[model samples]
Target: MSLEVLLDTNTCIFILNHRPPQVAERFAEHPIGSIGVSSITAAELSFGMHKSGSEKNLERLKHFLTPLAVLPFDDEAARVYGRVRAELQARGTPIGPLDTLIGAHALALGATLVTNNTREFKRISGLALEDWL
Candidate 1:
């Protein structure tokens, strides 16, 4: 169950929209099953789809998610989240809750996080990160 990379919500959206060539190329480098998403990302995408109220977008999102593995925020991830959140808070640099969860999940799996929001994701120590965009 070795996961090579975890796609962030932003990356997923970019892939779906096909607006950025670099991101698409980066994503193409990885095998379909090797790429994954946090359950948090799935939820976030679903939220955005619901908010947009566009059936076409919903179908596109569904098709986009079909091939990628979705990682869960299990107990180990929760523990990591607690430590990460506390450390960030002590440092007075709290990030978004969803980002924290994504970071924690990536850390637990030892997978690199792929996101354009490196500014915020980099705040978590020991979490590998890459920005395709």
Candidate 2:
């Protein structure tokens, strides 16, 4: 059975920059299904790309994500963010606010979250965390 890995923001960047073999290997491990990317990840990438002053790289990033399914910051996701945050706080998981939001989106979509930063996100009980670190 293949897993629908929701590419985390950091792993997404690493995969896009061609800097990590682990991310690619993970894809190969579960390629039969599809990949999911969050818009929050795109915002993070755009912010970083803008800081680097590389329009070409930004274009490349856009093209890279064009084929993946996008998990938008929709109302349902926002609602899940609140619930996920409450659950995490109650469970003593101190992930950063942004990561919480991203993980919540993955949870709402029922997709396994693929990331390098697992410690923070693993705190949320239902977040299927897969590390590519």
Candidate 3:
């Protein structure tokens, strides 16, 4: 299925934790296969699961990921990453490494990045962003 929105790590966490009701509400407004997350985001969630040392949370994450697409970080995304990273670094407004990857991934796929961290992702030109929180 083609992904229309690529959820960033923080957005996914918000959905998983069910903190702000609007995130889930907005997420529910989308068709199931139309939304997804980058593999980088999945890795970040998995890292949190391991760090928490909770099998229940790991299982919860697994269940939460069932209906969502997990797009890989392919060569095209890597190419975007190289260009975006260099541009941000040159401008002296570089974001975190993983955030760079996430933004580049969404740009490579031509998908809107659903993230609450707009201040950081906004540095990369041509990257579409939506804040769900």
Best by lDDT: 3
Tens-place lDDT digits, model 2, residues 12-73 = 87787677777776665655447778888878877888998988988988887777776688
Order of quality (lDDT): 3, 1, 2
> For model 3, how does the per-residue alpha-carbon lDDT over 1-133 read when each residue is reduced to its tens digit?
5789999999999999897989989999999899999999999999999999999999999998999999999999999999999999999999999999999999999999999999999999999999987
Pick out the ten consecutive residues of candidate 2 with the lowest summed lDDT: 24-33
Select the stronger candidate by TM-score from 1 and 2.
1
Model 2 residue 27 CA deviation in Å? 2.7
Query: Can you list the residue pairs that collide in candidate 1?
Result: none
Candidate 2 residue pairs in clash (backbone atoms < 3 Å): none
User: How many pairs of residues collide in each model?
Assistant: 0, 0, 0
Per-residue lDDT for 54 in model 1? 98
Better of 1 and 3 by lDDT: 3
TM-score of each: 0.96, 0.87, 0.97
Model 3, residue 113: displacement in angstroms?
0.4
